[model samples]
Structures are given as structure tokens and as C-alpha cells.
Target: MLREAPAGLPRQAELAATPFFPQERYQCGPAALAMTLGAAGIDVAPEALVPQVYVPEREGSLPPEMLAAGRRNGAFSMTVPPRLDALLAEVAAGNPVLVLQNLSLPWVPLWHYSVVIGYDLDRTELVLRSGTTARTTMALSTFEHTWARSQSWGMVTLAPGRLPRTAQEAPTVAAAVAFEQANGAAAARRVYAAALERWPQDLALLLGLGNSAYAAGNVAAAVDAFRRAVAAHPDSAPALNDLAFALNAMGRRREARAAAQKALSLGGPWQEAVRDTLRSIDAAPRRR
Candidate 1:
């Protein structure tokens, strides 16, 4: 496998410094999440996350619970594409991936969660912080077999300003929105800003960045972001409408009216919103 790895992927990579928390009983979810969050610079313990992710009734945690816990702790957490190559790419980029595996047969299931901290392509083995073991190495084929039973589910938790190496725009934006809902606009603003650097021409990311800034009370920055979105996608009605709204908030009534009019002229589903913005601009007295 090392001999046939994709270009730019290292033959072997290991994030040995990734933290570990041995699970107690059916607490692999919390333990694995703790390790991933810790590696992303969050000082959290498995016990602290037990309440957030652990389901005592089921004796295990759910995937949504695990992701929400990550977001609550200020990380841009998201599920990665279900592919071994995608997981390896994240690990090679120094992001530990939390993976779910059915360690038993399909009908007889033993669901488990572990953090993949390293891989040796030459040896065709993966290193993980598994149950009661800080460093457990499994053959790639065995790991894949177990992982396949779980539908290859995997997720990555990243600190603000960081992104998965193989991140897609839509998932990244969804993660930012989820982070905003869990944390706050300020933290999500940073997430959106960082994503914009990776995908400048992305309309959703630009709008997200601008909307987050506005929610955080930085109208000027919001206007700048929305202006950039409109510049990149001139035909985007939502961008022009948002830009108009932000400009009006900044007391730039004339420019706001112009943008709103343009948005109304290119109206689609956003026609009503543009009309409202123009009405507000007209209702407000001109600045002296």
C-alpha cells in the first residue's frame, strides 16, 4: 500500500503526541472523543465528556452526541467522507480521526469507538488509542473489515482556524453552522473566516462569515464579507440582500438602497427580503 499511495501522501505518518484516555466499560465514545478534543487543544477529560456523550441506557454513545460535544467545546467537528483514504489524509495532516467500528460480525455487533492517531503504510497497519490501550496497532485489512461494518463512519474535531486536509465546502459550512448553534457567533465567525481562506469563492462560506460577524456585532466586518460574496457571485441575490442589510446597519443608506434595488431587480426567492430591506432604507432618515 505504501508503494501505491496517492501522490503527496507520506508512506508513513504517526501523530504519536495525540492524547489518550482509556475507556471504562462501554465508555469508548467519551474516551475517544476526549483524545480527539485534547489533540485539538481542548483540555477535556473522558469523565467530563461522559455525561455529554455517554448513553447509560445503551451503554454507549451516539454519533450525533459525540459531534455535539465537540462543538460545545469550541471545535469545528464534522464527519469526514466515508473512505479510508479520507481518514488517512486527515491523520497525515495531523488531525486525529474518531472512527466507529463494529468489532464483531454483522448480526452479532460489538460497536466500538477509537481514535486513529497514526498509520504505517509500509507495514499496512494503523495505530489507535483503543480500549484500555494507549497504542494499539491493527492490520489495515482487519481495521477496514471492522470499520466497514459500521459503514466507515469517521469524524474529525479541529480547533478554530484549522480544517481537515480533505475537507469539502458544504460539510465545512455545515460544521460552522453547527458550531455557531452550539457555541456562539464569535467562535463560528473564526471558523467561517478560516474556511473562507481555503475557499474564497464559496458563496455559502462568505455568507456564513458575514452572518456570523453580524451576529457577533461586527457590522463593518460583516459588510466586508458580504461585499466580497457579492463580488465573487454577482448573480447571488442572497449575497446582495445580505450586503444591503449590513450596509443599512452601518448607516450607509445610499449604498444600501442601491444594493437592495439591484437585489430586487435580480429577484428570485429573495425578492420579498430585498423589498423589506429597501423599505427599511427608505423609512430611515438620511444621515446628516
Candidate 2:
């Protein structure tokens, strides 16, 4: 995650054009969220996002609600590993990163969210779109101290097919699953395919591709993807069971039985699914 600052960017850079939507007190979450979505090319305002993120009992927005709000606006949100290098890379790559900082002491927490838009390597400074201020500057060291108090927690939300600089397979796949559960198979297919392109051997992503394909009635595509997933991880019973199901759908009874048997031998969390697949194959009319 330690990427050198690209020569393409200047010593100091800022997204001065980023719009500032004024926020009421205790609404920094919505305000920072509005700034993030706006920078991502979504024009939602702070007020419109209030009900989506605010929690009356907690007196602040919750992370799960914030993630859901991002998805509702047609993007996927996932946390990045807490590191200065990771943060700078996102800024250099033209993505505004939403960061959690303790404006006060760690023990006496003043949790605040701000967007990191730019940085100056020579001067060791960062520029943020903080609450009530369009452009706020803080020394990199000072910013690190505040950010560290929150364990450098940060997040990025992007439209489908747009990978973040610090993207990882586990979290990205988890985000994809949430998107699939909320939106549907079609949107999730894009996420699975995109992630597959990046991490070809990722077992979860491969399973996601196969599942989405199966749900969409593209059984041939499902078969091909499940085969690839099995090839990628032969020990994955879920992959073998899914391949068996796809084969059964394609009328390849022998291959289907073999796959199901292999899955059953592996003995995983999907044992019942494998057993069910075998029963279904037994019930189906034998191929001539």
C-alpha cells in the first residue's frame, strides 16, 4: 500500500471546485457524506442525506447506515486499511477519502468526519472539506495524530466497476454481497466480474460470479464460472456443489453425479446442499 507520490501530481493539490453544503450542529456526518458523494459526481445535499444517516438515540450517524446510504445513492462503500500511505494514494488517484478523526483527545473523543481532498508532500500538509469550512488545512503530523486516535478509519464509495486504490478481496467481496442483497443479481454480477478481473483466483468472488450467473438463468455461463472456481480451489465444496447443480441443469447427469459426490467427500458447511443436489440428480430422468 506504500505507493510513491506520482510525478503527475503537483507538490500541492486541491479540489477547490468541490461544493460545500452548510450543515447544522451535530450533522457533520451528513455534511461529510454529502461532500463525499458530491465529489464522486452524485449531487445529493446534506439535508437530503440527514434522515438516511442520523440516529436520534446515538446523537450521531452509525457506520452501517452510512454504508447503506452510499449504496442507495448508486455506489459501493468499503473501509480502507488505516495508513497514511493508503490515504495519500487515494487523494493522488483523484478519489476523496472520508476519514474519521478525534478533534479532541482520544479518551474524551470528539468524533468528526472529514474528506481528504489533497496533500502537499514538501510542506507536509493535508487539505480537507471539514464541517462548516470548504477548505481546511492541517499539518500532516497534526492530522496523523487526530486520525490515529480513530485508528485511521477511512472509507471510499464508488460506482460499480470502479476499484479503489487500496481495494482488498475480502472487504470488496463483502461489499459486493451487501450490494447484491440490496439491489439484485444483475448489479451484483458486474461487481463480481469486476473483482474477478482484478483477483482471478478469489474463491468467494468466483462463487459470487457463478451464483449471479445461475440466478440470471445463464446456466452455461454459470457452469463455466463454477468450473473455473473449482479449478481455482479444488477443496471448496461449495464450488463443487454449485458445479454439480449447473451440470445437472445442463443434462450432464454423469458429470453432475461425480461433482456432487466429490462435494460430499469434502464435507463442508454445504453438505446438505451437496446431498440435496445428489437427490435431485437421482430423481431426474437418466440421460439417454
Candidate 3:
């Protein structure tokens, strides 16, 4: 079951060939990072990324820092689910996954980062861009043993406006939030839009888009997003409270009043905010 490629995907898979960069000792983090980010769209050099990702105390690029660097380079460096099938499926779908592994024994743990660029099922080999070599080949079993020690950790970084092929709801939301923080709501708008396509009725995603739109002062867009969110989960207090605020901002006090009332009736954790929304709606001037 371990070597099985995802069904319906091609038996043999290789991503478009990209240039390779060699790493200095303890610089595998930067090398692997450059390979992945370069493919994603940014053309940054590994040396330029070293300051951001490398920590002297850590002796290697930390995974958390690597993710932060991905964000800084305009990608949401997401870790796919830690399973052989999941990793293979991502590669088969054309994503070059940056993986974490222990090159040394687990007890000793020589944490290394490498990019899995392709695989040949017939040969049962996985191709990697590691250290001084591009197209470094290892038996599937060997690769799995090393990778499994690192909890099968792999990044599925996506450039702006692109969504992950193996996305999960919670992680996508976290990435969306981080993307918004790093790139601002305008860039986040694109992320949220792409995410919504996959999870059209996800309340959190809708709220994210709504929040991003509202933060950008795009009240109309915010109203539309929050409305859709409330439609998906009608009694969501947070959604109703936010929708109430957007309507109030648009000077549609009557509608805001109703939404706020429903949220308050739900008596959820947002009740305080719901009461506040109702107060503002009630205080606003009525339309002529």
C-alpha cells in the first residue's frame, strides 16, 4: 500500500525541471527553500534567504522559520498531511514538495530539508534536489524511512492566487490569515477568493473574505461576503454580528437591527458584540 501511487494519476510523474543550487554545510535549509520558492514564482537566491531562515543556535533552518520565509517570499508554505499517499498525490498533481527529514539516526537527528521533485513508480525511486545534486535518487523505502522520522513533514507552498491541491479547512484558514497579515488584505482577497472556490460555504473562509474586504474599506464587498456567510450558517453569531456591522456601516440600519437581534437571540459568545451592534444600529439615523 505504501508504494501505491494515487489512482487516476499518471504512473510515472516528473515536474518541470528547474535549476538547482548547492548548499554550504548546515545550509540545506536555504538550498531547499530556494528550490521550492523559486518554483513557486519568487527568484530569490539561497544566500539572500539565509538571514531570514537560518539561526546560529539552531545549526540548521528551522521548519517554523522556513514557513515564515515562505510567507515573506509571497507564498503560504503549507505542510501537507504526513502520509506517503498524500505526498505522492501532491507531487503527481505537480507540486514540488519541500520535505523535512532526519539524515542522521532519529536519536541523533540530523534535520535536513530537501525538495521532492519527482518519482518513478516502476523504479520505486523518489527524486530530490538536495545538497550539491539535483535529481538525487533514493529508493522509495529509504526515502520513506527518513521522511517518516520527520513526521512526513512537507510543505505545499503556493504563490498568490493559487490554491493547494491537498488543502484542509483549518490549515487553509490559518494560511489565509497569515497571508493576509504578510501581504495585506488586498493580496488576501485573492487567497480568500481562491479558497472559497474549494469551500464555497465554509463559514470561516467566508468570514475571512468578509473580514479582509471590510478591513480594506470595501464595505460593499464585505457586506456581500458576510451575507453569504450568514446564508451558509444562518445562526452563526459571529457571522450575524459581522453582517450587522457591515449593514450598519452601509447606513442600512433596519437590516442591521434585524441581524443584530438574531445574533443576540442566539446568545452566543459574541453576545456582547451583538448587543453593541444592536446599540449602534438603533442609534443610527433612519433612512428617509
Among all candidates shown, the one with the greatest TM-score: 1
lDDT of 3: 0.86
Error of 3 at 122 (Å): 1.2
lDDT of 3 by residue, 1-288 (tens): 384567776667777565588988899989888988888777889999999999888788878888888988888777888987777888887788999988789789888899898888889888888888877888999888889888889997777778768879889888888888888886688789898998899888899899889988899999999999999999899999999999999998888888988898998578888888898888888778
Evaluate model 1: give its lDDT: 0.90
Q: Which stretches of candidate 1 lie over 4 Å from their true place?
A: 1-3
Clashes of each: 0, 0, 0
lDDT of 3 at 99: 94
Q: Which tens-of-lDDT digit does each residue in 101-214 have in candidate 1?
A: 999999999999999999988899999999899998999989999999888999999998898988898888888878888987767888888898898999988998999899
TM-score, candidate number 2: 0.86
> Listing every candidate in turn, what is its Cα RMSD in Å to the true structure after a full C-alpha superposition?
1.7, 3.0, 2.0
| C-alpha TM-score for every candidate | 0.94, 0.86, 0.92
Write out the backbone clash pairs for model 2. none
lDDT tens string, model 2, 60-148?
78777888888887677778879888788777777788888998996788988888888888878899988888888899888988899
